[model samples]
Target: MRTSYFICGIYVLMDLASSDERSFRIYFDEFSIKYKVPDIFEKMDSTLVQLNNRSYINAEMILKRDVADLNVRAIMEFWKPKAQTNMKLYDVRVDGCNLLQSINKNKLFNFYVKSFKKHANVILKCPLKANFSYKMVDWFLDENDLPLFVPLGTFRTITEYFTQKRLAIRVLVHGKVLPKS
Candidate 1:
């Protein structure tokens, strides 16, 4: 018996008989955050004037056996008072095949920051709510025919810092995934 192969544009061709499953470790290599104030009065407040915030986060996803888990670490720094808070996210599990299927079919995916630990000087009375959604704006195939996803999305976080003072931060996140070695 003989078999013929065809390469059409950027699509990758797969064989049904191949027992080898492609294992990919996707890295959330680059991410950025920008803070916004919805109210003009709040932006002009004197106490809030010193609120200069910056954040750096690194995250990665890997397949351990049949389960996929995500690990994320974030450091948020506040100026004026010179304080920083560290947060670590663990045990975030998702079906690896389902995630890839969603990306391939809809070009969109959603994930939750289900658990995290935070240490700060001032604590909030209510827990923060965070939602993350990613939409694939573009993608390309590598030399090995592995697809690299380039997604642009938004992250919204709501927290009550003080009595009757609620802060909502919407960050514009742009990220790319690279296959881990």
Candidate 2:
């Protein structure tokens, strides 16, 4: 069938693949996060990390946004890295608990320092908590220094590239939600 698509102008594209099992790809697109779930509808094979021989998956990723007061709660994803190629995401929750919890700013600062010490090559910035709320953690980073989030295409696209994996990170900055205009 022909599907209407628009990038700059309207165009028609052929749509194949049966409607049974499908996959959803999530990628960070500049300001907001974008998710694409193929039209194929049956059941989705939710695999967090599809690696080679080793496979490990996280249950879920929760993101709480408080736009009114520049604050956001990011509940980290929980995953157990198995052998080397077998990875799967068991649970997927966006708002759960803060895994990396530091008692106070001093502790958080120390934790950040230690993390950088371990991952020397990586550029990880110090995390800052929003003045309004503690749950909302924001990273202080300049525009030039930011990490790029790329999502691998679909099964067809996967073959073109390699397995979907987060490329090298440029810099780690805590993100803060700003009041909507």
lDDT scores of the candidates, listed in order? 0.26, 0.23
Candidate 2, residues 1-181, lDDT tens digits: the string is 2343253233222122222222222221122222232221122122233243222222211223221111122222222223234223122221111222331334423443443334333222223222222211222122212213222221100101011221211111112222112
In order of appearance, the predictions have TM-scores of 0.23, 0.16
**For model 1, the run of ten residues with the poorest summed lDDT:** 43-52
Residue 40 of model 2 has an lDDT of 15
